[model samples]
Target: MKKLLFLVFALGSSCFLFAQDETVQALKKDAERTIQKDPNDTTSKTWKTGGFVGINAAQGSLSNWAAGGDKFSLAVNGNLSLYAFHKKNKHTWDNTLDINLGYINTTSLGSRKNDDRIDLLSKYGYAIGPKWNVGALFNFRSQLFKGYAYDDDGNRTFNSNFFSPAYVLLSPGVEWKPNNEFSAFISPATVRWTIVKNDSLAAVGAYGVDPGKHSRTEFGAFASLNYMKEINKMFSYKSRMDLYSNYLKNPKNIDVYWTNMINMKLTKFLTLTYSLDLIYDDDVKLFGENNDSPATQIKSMLGLGFLVKF
Candidate 1:
């Protein structure tokens, strides 16, 4: 009778231990599945940030070649772009800042500025529907250094300087965003300011401000369309266009600014880039071919450079 009782007690203990082990294994599997379903559990991220910086250079040297060109030419260009985006449920905010500067040296032209650009844009929106949002947009643009025009005699004439043609725009508008790559905004009411801080340029009424005045203000209606797309693993394109009409002045006359950029990746850190810009403003004047008037302006650049992204 003593042996029988001992065996029964040992068997009961073993069964209890085995049951506990099975329960623990089941719990572990359940926990892993839950983690696999939701990696962050309850927390969600709302911000995304990225940017890229690039530098491009070109150099050419001619000996006794028949083709007529400068004996030696060199150009260097640099550009930077940074952006931040936030989206959580019904609220969204986006910001971008871009800078570009370049210079070129030639036997005849010496050294001169080839490119200059500064641009910033910010927008905040609250979604009211699946595709529409109410938003406020702000934009600022200017150059970082002096720019000049060269005469036939190779004489340089000062045309612009830092803040000489700065532009500031603010608008409260409705935006339509179908996806992450396209957006359109329209505002019936907008305010724009043109600033020429340089005393000499301001005195000349540069960029449409009154002579001797530092700034000009206008109320306008504004519309902008933006698009970006990655065509493949190695190519991408971006474009934006803006239009504005001053309500207080000639509402029939419109101001336009358009920009486009295309990139082709050759390697992880090397890219070929092309950029074009078009601008038209009635208030801005340019002098060329003995004509001094407001005219459409266009610029283009192409280069291959090292690119770093973050």
Candidate 2:
């Protein structure tokens, strides 16, 4: 009878252990699912950061082709962009910095700059309504290196250098953001400054600064529209346009800057990109094939490249 009781007790203990093991396994899976559903627990993410780097290249060689072209030509370009966004409660902040620099070598022109750009934008906002906010915006733009204009004879004339024609803008504004992909900011009170740090360029009154002076200031009204969207899994686009009218000077003449970029993903690390940039500044002069006046400046680039995103 004692043996029988011992056997029964052992059987009961084994069943209890098996049941406990099953319960533990079930709980483990449930905890994992809960963690997956709420990766950050009850708190929402407050900061997001991402950027991309791209490199593009092209080359051509001709030995006996009927078409007239350089015997050998090669171009390589690189671009980098970084962005950070923060949101908590009714406060939001966004920032972006972009840099582009590239070079080209050809039989005709040897080596020259193919691209140069630097842009920075920052904005902070407090929500006044669901889709509207009171905000402050800041922008800075310059170049990384000296740029030159080359004539047909391959003679070069200095055009711009680092900080030689830098621009700064600050504004307190109302911003309307209907969605994550679009925003419009308008400000009646804005300040703009233009700086030419190069003594030679400053002496020539380049970029509207007074001759021999290194800086120019203006009070203005400003407006800007920014848009970014991924059209599909393979395509994306971004654009921004800025307009400013100087209240202290010619209020009727407005300065404009617009930029657009499009990307088509060909593979995980390959992309085709196209970019367009336009600027119109009343104080700046542009010489074109048929016009030497203050014409609208335009630039376009298209290439297939390797892209990395994070």
Candidate 3:
């Protein structure tokens, strides 16, 4: 249902965008006007929309090279981030969607998914003060393709897939938004759903769901912080942190997720991006010598690609 909602909203946004015949020159003029306006004025722009799309690819062929490497290798990665924000008459609505997908093919390892992610966030707030608001926040995250890990015997164990495991979180809370670039939201009443729809996975109780159930619900206290800073036209940074503590279960065992991204525009069309993500869930156990123990998860990526902005 969360995924359905996201797709519906995404489709509506796309139709709305195409319905307007906005030109590149007009957008440039609008950008010029935006630059001239008071940067700190939150109400200066009633509707704001933009996004970045990038693609990176690499290929290598080795012919008896001295350095040991795969005979043939290729990698391709693509990412998109879109945001739409509206602020008027003490009411604000913000929505964002981010997707990343990658694949690698090598003579030794075969083709596999190196990265995959789908994330959506939406929030609506009614102001109570200059920097405080009553709001409801919703977020959904999952992946796109099947994931597996290979062992010495060349047997692959299924780990994840599209919607095989997903997370949906919703909270009605107070938000402290000091400026357009920063916000913190917290609430004691929060509901989170951990979903594992695949029958094979649910049979084994993957992702903390019951052995025969497709989903698990948790009532918890949740807090999140989001911030973005642009040092200059060429450099920018964004980060988000989320924390949750289940009141019905181990209340002291908290779940933490933090992610950061840095972007650099080297030229009109050239760009570089770096992303880091860290996650720790008390209910998730690692697949290792001690499968019962949980461990921190970390992922990082760096890319040089051609970028298009709108």
How would you encode candidate 1's per-residue C-alpha lDDT over 1-310 as one tens digit per residue? 9999999999999999999999999999888884355655777799999988999999999989898899999999999989899999999999999899999999989999999999999999999999999989999999999999888899988889888889999999999999989999999999999999999989887888889999999999999999988899799888999999999888999999999989899999999999999999988777657536778899899999998879
TM-score to true structure, per model: 0.87, 0.87, 0.83
Pairs of colliding residues, candidate 1: none
Instruction: Give the root-mean-square deviation of each candidate in angstroms.
Output: 4.9, 3.9, 18.2
Comparing 2 and 3 on lDDT, the stronger one? 2
Ten contiguous residues with the weakest lDDT in model 2 = 285-294
lDDT (Cα, tens digit) per residue for candidate 2, span 105-177 = 9998899997898999999999999899998999999999999878778998897999989999999999999
**Which parts of model 1 are misplaced by more than 4 Å?**
1-41, 289-291
Q: How accurate locally is residue 250 in candidate 2, as Cα lDDT from 0 to 100?
A: 85
By TM-score, the better pick of 1 and 3 is 1
Model 3, residue 9: C-alpha shift (Å) = 72
**What local distance difference test score does each model get?**
0.92, 0.92, 0.89
- Please give the lDDT score at residue 266 for candidate 3: 95
